[model samples]
Structure formats: structure tokens, C-alpha cells
Target: MKTKFLLDPNITFLNHGSFGAVPREVFAVYQQWQRTLENQPVRLLGRKLPSELRAVKSALGSVLNANPENLLLISNVTFGLNLAARSLNLQSGDEILTTTHEYGACLNTLKYLAHKSGARLVQQPVSMPLKSPEDVIEEIWSGVSPKTRLLFLSHITSPTASRFPVAQLCRRANRAGILSIIDGAHAPGQLEIDLAEINADIYMGNCHKWMLSPRGAGFLYAGSAVQAILEPLVVSWGWNVDTPATPEMGLLENLQWTGTYDPSAFLSIPAAIDFQRKHNWINVHMSAQETLSRFLHRFSESFNIPIAYTPEADPYIQMAVLLLPPIKDPEKFQNQLWCKYAIEIPCIEWQEHQFLRVSYQVYNTEADLDRLFSAIEDLMPSFLTTSSHTKSGSL
Candidate 1:
């Protein structure tokens, strides 16, 4: 798997949740698409791109168990979220309900929407040591009110690495007449995605994160019922400004052609799907979590840190955020792992606590985890000393 990917072999990459690494085969297709686009710009962009992209969408639809007509190619999830936020046309006193465990960029997007429309953004806390899906559902549902116009949540939260019971919540939102949007940025390739099953009004996912596609590959899925209300972020061929909007125009006509950039990333999606299938990635994904679970136990005992919870839950399938002892400077500790040890993993400060969010991809080997553990052991003393001095108010 390591040889299959194009990541720097010198660095131990434990963070695939942040921009994903592209497989060599998929990258070859990406490069080929770029060359093809450059080879005959007019022929491809003007005539061939739409059909070719439709083929890609059809392929993606198969993977997601969705209709190609419902999906639109996007640069990333952030773009889709911003589009959803602004298009909904929230008014004064409207509330956008979400949990505190959501991604930061999405929180900002909702914040902007709230400020612009005089709406409210209620971040209900889901609390630590998550117990059960039913409990989590009731906890988040408490935030919904009469004025709750839209319900936005992550299918998988970025910071906490939690797989929310989105289907249950989306069903609740649907019954309540609240529009539901899911940011599934870290879902594809890592977990099974069935857009129909999730049943959200709008759903967005990034293929670049876990799907092994080239960076900048993502898709936005809007249910047929809600597609009518969506306003494209950029007005292009999508907008029939002078002419009346046509019923035949779906996501393809409304949001697909927003001034051409590079379609290579989007085009490479089929190849990425092929790569995972050829490698039997479902078993691989499951195996990764099993290995990480075993490693976490050892890591917890060796470091004398209490286990927060078992990552056997869907929320922690291939990725898990492990608890770490309080550090005076989490940034410096993270830098030491990167600058000194050449280990690429995220050390996060969330909710006044420090953490190590490890992403176990197919490329991560036993040696890579060993390298990370060794480096942490070497630097643990210094980190603890810094915490002691900082707490004592002495340098």
C-alpha cells in the first residue's frame, strides 16, 4: 500500500484526515486527464467534459447508492456547505441547530449565515465519553426549536472523529420540516456511503480525503425536493438569469459548469473507485481499525493515560482521537513530532484538552506506528516538564 501511494516515504504519515494522499494509479489518471484537457482544450471543455463528467457522476452514484442527476462535482466540502448556507435564505429569528462537535469551517459558515440574516446558531454540546446513538440523538435534538429552520451536522466530525447517527437525526429533521445538511468530508472510501439511506436534504462528501482520488475532488448531493431552492455560489451557465429556470435543469445544469478550472481531479474519481475495488478496501478499512485498537491499548498503558472510550464504534472506524496528558505547549509538542521526528499527525487542543488524532490508512504499517510511539516516549519527559513549569508560573 505504501508503494501504491505517492506520499513522501521519509515521513511517517498518521494523518490522512487532512488532505488525503493520492494513489499512484489514480494520480496517473489525473495526470492523463490534465494532459488530455491541455491537448484539446476546446474539444474537451466545450464538447466532451459534460458527458465525461456525467459518466464520472454515474460511477460515483453507484458507489454512493445515489442518482447521478442528484450529484454535482465540487472542489471541496467547504464550498458545498457555504453554498447550502447562503441558498437556504434564512430570515431573522431563524435558528441553525448543530452540535459542538462539528468542523470549525462549517461552524464559521453557519456563523456568517446567522450574522447576515439575523438568525441564530445554536451549538448544543454532546459531552465527552459518548454513550449510545439514541442518547446522542436526544442530546442533539434538544437544541431544535420552533424557529429552527435548518439542521446542519457532520456525518463524521473532523476534530472528534465521531460518526454521528445522521440517518436518525435526518429523519427527525425531516419530520420536523427542518432542512438537513450533512458534511461528510471524511466519509467516502473510509466508510460505506448510501445517500438514499442517510436521507438528508443536502449532503456533501470529499473524495480526496479517504477515497484515494487526487486532491480537489468532492461531490454535493441534493435531494430532488430541495434542489429547487439551491442558489449556486457563482452565477454562470447554471443561472438562467435572463431566461426562466427550466424544469429539465437539475444539478448538472444549475451548478456543474461554474467557469472551468481543472476537471482532472473530478475525472479521476472513477479510477479511484477502481483502485479501492481492486485492493478490496472494505476489509482493509476494517483491518486498519482493528490494528489501531490494539495499538491504542498499548499506547494507553505505556503512557499511563486512561482510555476515553473504545474506538470499536462506527465513529472511530479508521480514525480515532486518543487522549493525551496535559501539555504546556501542544503546538511545540506537535512541532517536535513533525520537525524533529518527521511524523505527520495532528496534535489538537479541543475543549481545553489535548489530543492525538491518528488516522490509520492502508498505507500505515506497523513500523510507522512503532516510529510514532518511540518519538512520543522520547519527548514525553520534556512535555511534562514544560507543563509543570507553566502551571507553577516559572519558566
Candidate 2:
């Protein structure tokens, strides 16, 4: 599986939750689309691009269990969320409620929108040793008020790598008449996504992360009810409500043609999906989960570091956040791990605690976890002992 990917073989990569590695075959398809567009730019852009986007949408919709007409292909999750944030009609004194576990970019987008609209952006706090879905629901729902016009949350958190119960949360918001906008950036490939079942008002995901598509591939999905409120982030030919050039152009078409850029990554999404399907991704996912669980147990026992969550209760399928012994400088520890050992992984600082997030993909193996363990074991003593003054001086 590792051999099929374009990732550098020399480096141990445990950060698939970040920018994903593209398979060789998928990259070939992506490049071929680019070449085809280059060969006949006018025809492809003018005659074929619309149909191509529609086909891609249908393919994605089938997998996502969403309506093709309601989906818009965007560059990444942040881009999609930006479109959503701008489209939302937030007003003075309204609150857009979210949790602290959200991705920073999305959080900033919300903050910017809140500032622009005079709406308050509230960050609901969630604690570690995370409890059940019901508990999380109650804690998060406590933040919701009559002023909460929007509910934004991550399906799988980036900082702590905890999977929130978005479906239940969405239901709560829907009952309260609050619009639900879920950031599923890490969920498309990491978990089973049946948007039909989840029923959020608006949802967005990144295909470039766990989905294994080329970079800059993501989609924004809006429910039929919310279509009218969606305004285009960039005004273009497809949508000019004042002029009304083509009244037929709906939300999907209006947002799809947001100027000319490389749509090759978007086109190759089906190839990435097909690659996962052919390989029996569920088994691969289970294998990786089991491997991760084993590694977490051993690492926890070896270092006497407490595990954040029980294995049975943890919802982080392939990615687990391992709490580390208190380190003086997390940034230095992360840099040293990558620079000294070529072990590429996420060392996160959340809630004033240090954690190492390990991501397991189809391309990863038990050997990769062993390498990480060995590297950290060798570096932990020095990392803990190194004086903050020394680190500050070096910096």
C-alpha cells in the first residue's frame, strides 16, 4: 500500500490527517486531466467543464449521500467554510456558537464574520477524558441560546483528534431553529458520511485530507431549505441577481464557476474514491485502528503517560491523540522530532497540555508506529531536561 503512494519512502509520515498523500494511480489521473485541459483549453473550459463538474458532483454526492444540485466543489475545507460564512445572514447581537476543538482557519473565519456583522462568536469549552456523546451534547448545547443563530462544529477535531457527535448536535440545533454548519474536514475519508442520516443544514469536507485526492479538493453541501440564503462568495457570470442573466442558474451552478482555476484535483476525486473502494478500505481502516490501539497501549505503559480516552469509548477512528509528559517547549520538541529523526507527525498543544497526534492511513504500517516510539523514547529525556532559557537563547 505504501509503495502505491507518491510519498517519500525515506520519511516516516504519520500525519495523514493533514494534507494527504496521493496514490500513484490517482496522481496519474490528476495529471492526465491537466494535460487534457492544456491540450484543448477552450473546448474543455467552455464545452466540457460544466459537464465534468456535474459528473464529479454526482460521484461525490453518491458517496456523501447528498443531492448533486446542492454540492459545490471548492479548493479546501477553509475555502468552503469561507463561502458558507459569507453567505450566512448574521446580524447584530446574534451568536455563532462553536467549540474550542475547531480548526484555527475556520475559527478565524467565524471571528471575522462575527466582527463584520456585530455578532458574537462564542467558544464552548469541552474537557479532556471526554465523556459519552450524550454528555458532550449537553455540555455543547448549554452554550446555545435564543441569540445563537448559527452552530458550527468539527465532525473530527484537529487539535485533540476527538470525534464530536455532530448528528445529535445538528438535531438539537434544528429543533432550536439554529442553522447547523458542520466542518467535516477530516470526516469524508476517516468516517462513514451519510449526509442524509446526519441532516445538517450545511456541511463541508476536504477531499485532500483523508480522502487521498490531490491538494485543493473539497466540497460544500447545503440543504434544499438553505439554498436561497446562500450568496456567492465571488460574484461571477453564473450569478448576478440584480441583472438576472440566467434565472435558471441555481446555487450549485452559481458557485461552481467562480473564475478559471485548475479543476483537475476536483476531477480526480472519483479516482481517489475508486482506489479506496477497490482496496477494501474498511478492512484497511480497521487494521490501522487496531494497530493504533496497540501502539497507544504500549506507548502509554512504556512512558507512564495517561491515555486521554478509553479505547472502547474513543471515537477517533484512525487518529489518536496521545498525551505526553509536560514539555517546556512543544514547538522545539516537534521541530526536533522532524528535523532529527525525519518522523513527520503532529505534536499539538491543546488546553495547556502537550499531545502527539498519530494518524494511520492505508499506506502506514506497524513499523511506522515503532519508528515514532523509538524516536520519541530517545528524545524525551533531552526534550524534558532542556532549559527554557537555552531554548529561548537558541531561538
Tell me the tens digit of each residue's lDDT in model 2 across 281-348: 88887887788888878987887766777544567788988888777688888888899999899899
The CA lDDT at 191 in model 2 is 88
For model 1, residues 1-395, the per-residue Cα lDDT tens digits are: 89988889999999999999999999999999999999999888989988898999999999999999999899999999988788988899999999988988899999999999999999999865565788889999999999999999998888888788899999999999999999999999988899999999999999999998998899999999988788889888868868645558564456877897888999999999999999998899889978888888888788777555533344577888777777768989999999999999999887866778999999999898999999999998878854543432211
Per-candidate TM-scores read 0.96, 0.95
Backbone clashes, each candidate: 1, 0
Tell how far residue 89 is off in model 1, in angstroms. 1.4
Tell me, what's the RMSD of every candidate?
Answer: 2.9, 3.7
- Identify the runs in model 2 with alpha carbons over 4 angstroms from their true place: 243-248, 385-395
lDDT (Cα) of model 2: 0.87
User: CA lDDT of 333 in candidate 1?
Assistant: 92
Go through the candidates in order and give each one's C-alpha lDDT: 0.87, 0.87
